[model samples]
Target: MNDRLNLFQAARFGSPFGSPFGSPFGSPFGSPFDLAHQAGEYWLDAWQRSVLFMDAMRQRGDDHEEKLTQAAPHVLNFEFDVVMDGRDLARPVNYSLLRIHTPEGVVVDANRRPFIVFDPRAGHGPGIGGMKHDSEIGVVLRAGHPCYFVGFLPQPVHGQTIEDVCQAEARFIAKVAELHPDADGKPALIGNCQAGWQIMMTSALNPDLTGPLVLAGTPLSYWAGVRGKNPLRYLGGLLGGTWLTAFTGDLGCGIFDGANLVSNFESMNPANTWWKKEYKVYSEIDTEAERYLEFEKWWGNPVLLNAQEMQYIADNLFVGNRLSSGSIHDSAGRRIDLRNVKSPVVVFCSWGDDVTPPQQALGWVLDMYQDDDAMALSGQTIIYALHETIGHLGIFVSATVANKEHEEFTGAMDLIDVLPPGLYEAVFVEKTKDTVNAGLVDGNYVVRFERRFLDDVRALGGNDQEDERRFAAVARLSDVNLGLYRTFASPLVKAAINEQGAEWLRQLHPYRLRYKLFSSKSPLLFGIAGAAERVRAQRAPAKPDNVFTMLQEAWSRQVVGVLDQYRDLRDSAVERYFMNVYGSPVLQALVGLRADDGRVRQLGRDIARETVAASARAKLVEQAGVGGTPEAIIRALLYVLRAPELRAADERGYAMLRELRTHSEEGKVMSLAHFKDVVQQQAQILSWNEEAGFVALPLLLPPSSAEREHALDVVRQVAGAAGELEGEAAERMARIAAMFSAAVKLAG
Candidate 1:
């Protein structure tokens, strides 16, 4: 054995072998001895990484166990006191409303609008919204807003339903409003992922309860997605529409294990879930363990839901796609129309979010209104912002986003609340050295509201008529399958299992078993902690230039590439299969659907209401030449900045406007609501007839030369706060100035 080892080592290092083969290659790469030494170091480092990786797994399992022991098991990093418990409400649920204790050195304004963050209850436990210092709750608090959190327990209340939860949320909002009676506006509601639709429904039913609403990575139009890009939408049809969900719920004996949903999410990205995630931690075990373990504390602890809640979500929202279509109703049987939401809605979604793509986030606007005119006439202010590339969770939890997107959204809440009722795209651009009025800008970025049309939304991509028909067929078939199962299979399945048996099944689930198997209490991880400690004391991480480390990373990339390809192929095949099965005329006919008519469930137009709105707009247009300085200045500004492309604004300009409001005679007497009304009225007048609106602009201005000059100066200050007007904006501004000058000469 010694002689063989010697021979092998010598041949590899060119000691015993002839010099030509090893000597020639070794010059460009490295000396054989140098390579051998580096290889030995890599092996040692790999050994250390293995021990450290096992230790991280053990610590993660330990953390999961610790979380399970807590009564609420929330991941919120901030300390909070429970203001109201859902169990004490008329409609009991597992959720609770918490008032986040203001962090030291952070001063909160009592008169500012209070912020309530509603975290999603889809599969995972609550508190991802505030799990880190740079999170949704953190941003709200730092912005001097009174912050509140709506979180839930790991276990659901025994008889809780989705309706009960929605009711509970409404009550919570009312309580927040009542608590802050001196606040300038109603409480701003921030919803993440699943909570987005939930809050939207509650707001629709009780339209007056909320202020501006921020929905981050929310999916309202569940059935809307591109053809091959979204395969998760095809799952309902492939599984034959909600039957498996029903079966799984039945197997849980009235309780549904959220692990099932978590598993599905993991399946979406097998490369990340199974290999790359853990491998990255292993490769950088010295530094990555803490982050991996912290995230696992939330990701590993899947929360429970009552079977009824899951069924409603699957049947009504996921497969049925009823919410966006206005088919969902309250207990009073009133249709839950999205138009009923009185507050301005700011939707923040990402293009790279496969889970809740921009299509799903913004498609609801297309579903609710037929055109830009319909939306404007409905008196709903909708603003949507798109990120170039961010994943679903990153939309709310990422530190980078919290600093940029969430920060701007919250900072501009007051501005959004007073926006005229219409569709606008929120655009954010970086502040540069040459940016006009640089001192007026607040931060590294400037945010502006750009007017948009329905076509702008359609450009994001959505389903065709055939796709809608196919999804509708799936919805119809889902109802039939759910009914059949409830009648035939549910009773038998429920009878076979009780609560204790269900608990056993849940504990034995593959997702849960992995955590338990690697826990500190498990026999398998007996010596891992001590071994890891020893390795840590003698730690030696490999350098990036190490040959073995490079090979390891290369192998990992190849693995990920292969898995990604498999996912694409699988998704493509699944999409095609679904289209074929659900699009068949025979299947569609059986499911009581028709290809000739592509209209799925949608709210019919209320001609009477629209007629009343049109009349109101006409009356406003007839009086377009009315109002004094405020109306004229605002109208002139809107006219000059009327191009379809995005424009920029700063908070300082809004602040200046507010100061103007406080100092002026008309501003001191007018209320915020009245100001919004005036802005909207003037905007309508301009839309009706731009040329006539411009012709009547001087009529709206005061006859006194000084007053007219003051109003024009304010417009120039506010408009120029962004920068010197350019191109058409500059020409328009010049025209307005010329109009004012001519009006002044006549007055003289």
Candidate 2:
């Protein structure tokens, strides 16, 4: 085998909870009957567990329905008051804009910028983003920001499309701004998963309406992913394109089931979906029930989408992969171009997230601009933070994630905005115990922006033009197949199914039935409650040493492994079939696929306009980069800060310092906006050409010792407020101090 293959084989599997039983083989001398005696005892213990397991399942089902019934009509995870109903809008939809009512003790700073969050409407109800106290809303509330939530009804308006939803969200944001007129700036937007793209589209359309944008686990560049991973991206092509999606929506008789979307997510990892998730719960039901049921409440409350909405997404987004390419246009002929958004964009995604991988989250950067210089020339500040091992859901909802990543993200919004237009990877910094002046820090962890380039993003995505062509061909085929299906099968299917029948079919879905069977209505589970009580009173769970218990675990693991193997084999077959069928040159030619698969078919038209505008902006960018003293001062501070190779606290300290100085007695004489403009422009110029920017510092600052001394003091006051400087940080500060001192001594 090749070296790579050997490496893969070795790394794929890890020792599982290491076999405590040691060997399957037992005492060789033991008689069959004696073993049978022990086995009988083990069987009784196992039987008791079975009774308890059944009882737990029934209670879970009961809880599911009870929660559903209580949450009827609208189920919200956080407390909020309807600020403005969507029905009041000229173009109405079954959505609402809510102003979250913070808990009594949770202090909210009315002057602070408002945060508007939108949860993904992909197959699940809203509130996962704010379901727990330790969530996005929770984090925002803790930070004293007035929070807002944009949520939708369970059923969509009869003919709602993605465009309509975007309009409503834009309206909601505008309303949020109106409500917070006293606030410092426009409301910041945080969109999770599918909502991530929705907000981006809205931002592009109404660039002036929103503030900083945070997209968590959002996939803008759908086609960008690593090979041998992100298998779900291939499913659309494997399933013969979105024709099946249309057919499925028709079968639902106008409303598509979100449960199917959830199922698709589950099918991606059968080991987790079929066994591990449930096994973990079953193994620790005593302490697991509340948490398991809490998550299930959100997972199980699948929402419905109008057939129009689903088709629009599947065709335009999944099949066409058009959002990142600027191929999607709204009804009014306004191109929904992402580059139009001027707001600072912060992307939070994890490398472990299979649903929306890092490549998909970041790949859009590489696709949208020709290079990093092109991006900066456009005057956009894009920051992306990557977590090492969190899953897709954890990116937004995990309490640990919220407390650290999201807290830091929200606190640094101002800092992100003040940053010069460029590309950066936000890296987390470890906190030292002895850091001084902790009062300025907003969160536990510090984050530093590490300058990066388009190359870095493209490297992760490995933009394979070959794969692009295949997907393009698939899109072409999807159009053909969808046309055929609508002409032939769509009418017949629609004619046969009614809303009533569709509801029945939905209820009968295995996904729904799993919970229904545990309801009090199920005859088989009538006595489970009583039996569970008895089992609970006389319970005796077998320990790990029990032979039968060991055997059961072994058997269960084998079954899960077999299911995983089948899943892998099936996925492999599907991928192979898709590639073979779509890989044909003839098929590609028929679809008019070009050398680069028309991946940037629209780039020629878009980039030319961008280039001319960028050219106009270039002169300004250069001047800003090389401006006099203010630019030099910021450059010097940034150089010292970065020299330590340590992550400093949030950029908030710097932005705040600028704000505070502007309002100070001395600051009253300075133009805050002009100062910020100078700082940002100078910082960018220095970053673009560090060596020259460094050389120009002394020329910009006064040659006198008193003035130089005063500048250094300000830098120390601002940078040190967030934390004490040590190690490389201290060294860099010392170098700056010495340089300023030398200037004065030499002058004399």
Q: Which candidate number maximizes TM-score?
A: 1
**Would you list the clashing residue pairs of candidate 2?**
436-724, 625-685
Candidate 2 per-residue lDDT over residues 1-748, each given as its tens digit = 3533433232222223332222233332133454575577677677776776677778768866775665333345667899877767777787788888988789998878899989799998767778888899988998899999888877787777788889999989998888878777678999999999999999999988988899999998877787667778888888778999999899899899998999999888889988888776666656676687778777877888988899999998888888888888899998888888988899999989999999989887876788767687666878999899999989987999998989988887767766667788887765656545444555676666777778877777644667778888888888988999999999999999998999998888888889898766799788988987887888766554544555566667777889989888887787787778888988888877765544433444576666766565565444643444345456667766665354433463575466334422243634433554665666555556656556556665665677667777777776666556788878877877777677768766
For residues 497-525, could you state the per-residue lDDT of candidate 1 as single tens digits? 98899999999999998999998999988
TM-score per model over all chains: 0.94, 0.86
Query: Quick one: best lDDT, which candidate?
Result: 1
Counted clashes in each candidate structure? 0, 2
User: Relative to the true structure, how large is the alpha-carbon lDDT of every model?
Assistant: 0.85, 0.76
Consecutive 10-residue window with the lowest summed lDDT within model 2: 20-29
Task: Please state every model's RMSD to the true fold in angstroms.
Answer: 4.3, 6.0
Give per-residue lDDT, candidate 1, residue 363.
Answer: 90
